[model samples]
Target chain A: MRLRLTPRDTSFFDLLADSASHLVVGANLLSELLGADRAGRKAIAKKLADVEHAADEATHSIMRRLNSTFVTPFDRDDISGLASALDDCMDFMEEAGDLIVLYKLDELPARVSDQIQVLQRCAELTADAMPHLRSMGDLTDYWVEVNSLENQADKIHRKLLAQMFDEIADPIQLMKLKEVVETLELAADAFETVANMVETIALKES
Target chain B: MRLRLTPRDTSFFDLLADSASHLVVGANLLSELLGADRAGRKAIAKKLADVEHAADEATHSIMRRLNSTFVTPFDRDDISGLASALDDCMDFMEEAGDLIVLYKLDELPARVSDQIQVLQRCAELTADAMPHLRSMGDLTDYWVEVNSLENQADKIHRKLLAQMFDEIADPIQLMKLKEVVETLELAADAFETVANMVETIALKES
Candidate 1:
């Protein structure tokens, strides 16, 4: 079950999706640095920073749209919650990247990239849910998928952290690994928040 | 320029501070283990767990009080936020203790114990601020002292974290040290959140 909305709702929802998309790219770019050169890692981190900055701008626009428009998609708090949740995800991702750079981590493990991919897909799936949000419809599938991706990210995160302590020998590297992995997991948590909020809003609309 | 309230508001405020006071004692007990016996540490951790459980119950009562009792000592949200924030501080403190046991961390740094003292003082200062929350009517002294204590805790948090990095030899220990210190900082951050909330309430009341 869901509620129906006009084109204006569609536009705002689309922009929100776009904002999430940019943030997802930023999060993935952070992981994309795993098998990269010192220069490559540095470059990717910068790209992440760039996208992160763009995501901030997108969030501001979303807020503006939220304040001005009257007839909207879903509840106002839901819209605002979605924006803040996406922003939090990006914030955690960017912080993970910054930690990697700050701690001078040379090579990232394979699992970090896997989590990043999951994060990217979650953002994409969440975007897909937005159009559905415009019309009162079955959002169970969307919410479930978003949550599934986040759970996958969670698995990847736990494995990475355990490996950091169990397998990694370099103490400095372990320190860096622990922080980055925790930060990555926080991003997943942020995505989960978004999914949960969406499910609640969808239920309300229905 | 603060809103004046009756003594009844002050007592309602005391319940929140009293919960935090219990947490302060738990924190002191947790930190005392750095110099105590093995059995003592375990006992203290258990005691802290008990305090944490009680704090949650107190928080729930405060929330119920807010909802059912229309005329709160202060604004409903202000009381609500203070109660919740105190709970968060206790949660982090309890979690940090849980990690210590889970990780089997043998000895805590002296600096951490020092931070506990700072945190306890912050809690005390926080408790003192509630009576002054409604207005500065001869209460500027307490308000100013609360802000000063919060600033002091912030500095201690930063310095203690830096000292931790300089002292730990093992990389794994370094990782754990960083996590513990960050949590401690977060504990202090919780106090700061309360102080900021109190300050805002004071300003509005004034």
Candidate 2:
């Protein structure tokens, strides 16, 4: 682990991490809805909203932690970045849910499914990376891998955009798809941010 | 007065701040070219190009500082947000340069000028706000003032958007105007992000 804090410092990372996973949970629900029947879609959408709302509360908790605690487990900057990055991941998930509702996407998008898989993978990486921050010999490998996932997200994002523009001749559809793809990529970017902060922390710990 | 850093911290804050103000200089120069005479307009456009280039350099420098530094004068997240916000402001100025070049808008736009003025004011406030972040006693007043500036920027953004939609008759023209105005407003939102980060830091510092 890169960071070697006593158990007291672990809670902050744990809470931040729980929030990060919750965002992934929200994304999972959203992805499931994409594949579900109409009734199931509606139900899953509602569930996704609930998850997103909970994620908001989680963000508040982290923010409160950020304010009250002075001797943070790690660098104060890393804590702030981690918290904001987690919140941003959730924000993107919520945006994806709302966008699904707004666009009334009748079926799951293949690209969206692909993107969600990437999001989930990164979430797992984030969860895994936290513990290693405590005194890991080297996390550059994890950092690099996480960056790769972000790039994969970017790949799908660009492909989806191109598909949207190429396959859908409608300007309005193009715009809508552009916004959706952008939001998805943004979610991945948040993960990349977490990765970047993690790398910084790793450097310090090393 | 609100921020409470040692004198050493102030020097770094000053550097980050100088980067921000330098972009405003670009904006101010760009504003002048808006209503310039034929040769004067061309001269100002070139000058705007130089300012835009300088902003790019500033952004690079800020990010480099982020990469190398361990103990920041301010919170890491605040630095990140401020760096982005500062770049965003410069981006707004760059877009103005693009608009000037694209539209052949020789005369300074009242609306554009208004937006630029607001932006300069916002940048100045942001510069002022950072110094206050380490001190908490006067934090409330500064935050209120920053919020007020943000509000003013929002109002202006709305009015500019309304003007774009209503007065611009041609579709192509509308597209150009909309992009410019929206970019400017987005820049304002970026500044607001900085303010919000500052408030968060203040809450922690206090």
Candidate 3:
């Protein structure tokens, strides 16, 4: 057997970590936009656009690296899945924020606060865990925490949906709130996917 | 530079094609579920579950192959992504069907028929494209058609959403219909993701 000497470019991990960090920024902004007034929310949304753009650039960097590199530190599929899932989380965050601004939703259900908080926790944990991907050590806790947070978010989602359908009178307002909440729920789901990807990689490597 | 002699396992393509075919099955059943009455829809949803289970098995086969194979016909990312995206399509399809049954929705918007038609077209195109993936010939048109179908589905989704929020008076009923439509929209989005993945692979390989 011929000995292979191609060096694994580890920069991809850094880029992924950078992308996860951007998710934290976007998720926090989403939480802030939930309570902001019209003008404030618009400004926050603009800031969110910047965050999403940064995450996009990070994702593009990852794709470029994947295309050029011959050998990766881990399977390319895991890397691609992680990058895309992180990008998705940011996209949903941006969508939720933009919906609030576009729909002019002045008031939201009370449980939205709890849901956003769960998202913020998921983001922070994602950012924290990404760096450890290089070592593939002590990462189970990250995914477990994210999974727990996602479950918490799901409970909030179900309760909020039930309350909206049962209590709201105006269909238009109900639809608007539902869209906003559902987007957040999707973002949470995406974060869970990312966590699952991380778990898969860790299991394979360990 | 040293030449390598390990044979690339190509069965991944077959498994992915199998998964895509299952998506076609699930999507067709979804179209049927929309037109189905109370008892008939439950039966259809059960059938969708079986399709989803088959797709899940196909996905697991891909994962097992990825774990054991040293060399793949294409980038492992594309293989795994294609499999997962196809699985997601079935999942969302199943979710939409189950929502219809669980929510006991008697009637959906007329525009939903158009959405289901677009999904059927996408499914057929995806199934046709999977066989060509091995040769990487004449696949561009497949992704192109899937993209066009997705765009058509988007238009229908927007119209349905607008109608739901504008016309529906009962919040509970509106809520059920919205969930059903949103799940179908998500399945359509998953199809677009699959198309994009195929395009990515085609661009890289050819």
- Please write out the lDDT profile of model 1 over residues B68-99, one tens digit for every residue: 56366666656766787888788778766655
| Leading candidate by lDDT | 3
- Per-residue accuracy of model 2 over A1-206 as CA lDDT, tens digit each: 58845344556767776777786677778678778767677788788878877876776677667667756777665676677777778767666766665555565458988988888888777777766666654568778988999999999988887777778865544544565678789989988988898887777866
Specify the poorest-scoring 10-residue window by lDDT in model 2 chain B: B4-13
Q: Each model's number of backbone clashes?
A: 8, 22, 0
* Complex DockQ, candidate 3: 0.17
lDDT sort, best first = 3, 1, 2
What's the true lDDT of residue A31 in model 3? Answer: 86
TM-score, cand. 2: 0.63
lDDT of 3 by residue, B74-190 (tens): 988778878888888889889988998999988888998888888888888888888888888997678668867875786687678767766787878887897888788888998
Considering DockQ, which of the candidate structures 1 and 3 is the better prediction for this target?
Answer: 3
| Candidate 2, B65-178: lDDT as tens digits | 777776776677667666777777677767766666677644333676777677677667776665565454565555567667766776676566545544555555555665
Q: What DockQ does each listed candidate score?
A: 0.13, 0.12, 0.17
DockQ of 2: 0.12
Candidate number with greatest TM-score: 3
Provide TM-scores for the models.
0.62, 0.63, 0.66
- TM-score for candidate 1, please give it: 0.62
Q: Which 10 consecutive positions of candidate 1 chain A have the poorest summed lDDT?
A: A1-10
